[model samples]
Target: MTTAATSTTAAAAVPFRFFDVHVVRTRLLGRSMVRITFGGAGLTDFASGGRDQRFKLFLPHPGQDAPVVPTEAGEDWFPQWRALDPATRGIMRSYTVRAQRRTDGGAEVDVDFALHGADATGHTSSGPAARWAARAGAGDRAVLLGPVEPDNAGVDFRPPAGTDWVLLTGDETALPAVAGILEALPDGTDARVWIEVPHPEDIQQLDTGAQAEITWLVRDGADGPRTGLIPDAVRAARLPDGTGYAWIAGEAGTVRALRRHLVGDRGFDRKAITFTGYWRKGATEEQLVEEALSGTGPADD
Candidate 1:
């Protein structure tokens, strides 16, 4: 591993590529959230654009010790990785760059995982990514496909210029990105945020300099079904006036409902609201990707 601190200057102008990284540490941020920090020699070239920055993490499959580092570069990497035998391919998942920092040891990136709930039998069952996070330890390796340039234009958080206020809404899966966006907002900027989580203990203390009004909604024990909680909360909240941008992400159905409420009921411009479905109720990420390839999945944006 590299012991030098990451450079603060601009990153080299390079295309996005795969970086082999190892777990530096893991910690519990909340009842259902585990933060895993990754660092390695390849992180020296890792550049983060902050707000809602996303990357593909290739995690080791069951019984495997580490992810197979793909040899192809740029656009060829995905095709090569896809062509591998299913039994040998690593589990690929999308995640947000919660934050990145330069430490005395090297550059480190944080990715937070939301632990899934248990079945009716009361036994805990999590997805592959969450299970990996739960058991991951120092020195465990994975592969990250992300931007090598600091200001990579692929980042999704593009609030229009002259935005007087901001509205942010999402579920547990989007917490990291929402937190990163809040922290990156200009100090004293007006913002409203609503985050829904599985448990009340999942509410975390977000460090943001923005003038943010935050509301946390607990869903696991809420009255009625959990499906409509997010949209209900959004429907009841008072929106701010003036030209503003709204960033909404969560389950596909809920995200669509919120977007419709903003555009149809609230009279906000469709172009001004940015929405994404982080996941669906029963659909896995792989399934969603397959559906997207076939033009059957929910709109990514």
Candidate 2:
């Protein structure tokens, strides 16, 4: 076995707080990805933990003008928000921080949204989060609950001390996170990445100096089940030799399948892999959260 790198360091710490931000602009990153740029006064204290850092976005429902931000006095924000009428309480969604930077005005963060088409019934129906991103414009405000300091436990990408190589696999929903992880890796770090998207145009240029070999699998109108493409591609590829760390995410079922393949068939140590179900095929994020709270969510180890 190849020896692991001995000089890797942990990410810097950051604080966690809530902020109210407004959309500065929106742009199409690819055929199925929309990049929304947000900025506001609250972002003055905003800090990001680089790789796979997640934040909660409170989006307004239709007919509501803006998201209703809860108080930060205590940890009752969730209960307080839930106490409000369902129609007016706004929806909460989780997303990865694609990029963050400080400007002359304040700070700005980019959030990439994956656009999905209509359901099996052919009715034009998308989830609330996707719908909000699709119609969001400049000046539209949303409440962001994220880190205000640099030393919190919000980030999820934790590579072990002896990790010499990396394997990253995911679908469109995990693209931003995967990109962030790749960019955070040191130069000369060996990594193999596999990302599955709905369209060939979804492949965007990644800015990273790491020694990475990326394979983008475009599932354009595949006849059979679509979820298997990512795992199939991962199963076919040959992994590099080393004490490797693998990060996998995307649809819940596929994530589990890929984890089994890595641990069972490929002989990767279960402790060496970090997997998360970003979303389930038919279930909503709300349901997934409920499952997690009940201690039944997909395992990350």
Clashes of each: 0, 8
Best by TM-score: 2
Task: lDDT for model 1, please.
Answer: 0.76
lDDT of 1 by residue, 95-122 (tens): 8898888877678999998766522233
Judge candidate 1 at residue 142 and give its lDDT.
94
* Model 2 RMSD vs true structure: 5.6
Error of 1 at 155 (Å): 1.7
Estimated TM-score per prediction? 0.88, 0.89
What lDDT score is found at residue 154 in candidate 2? 57
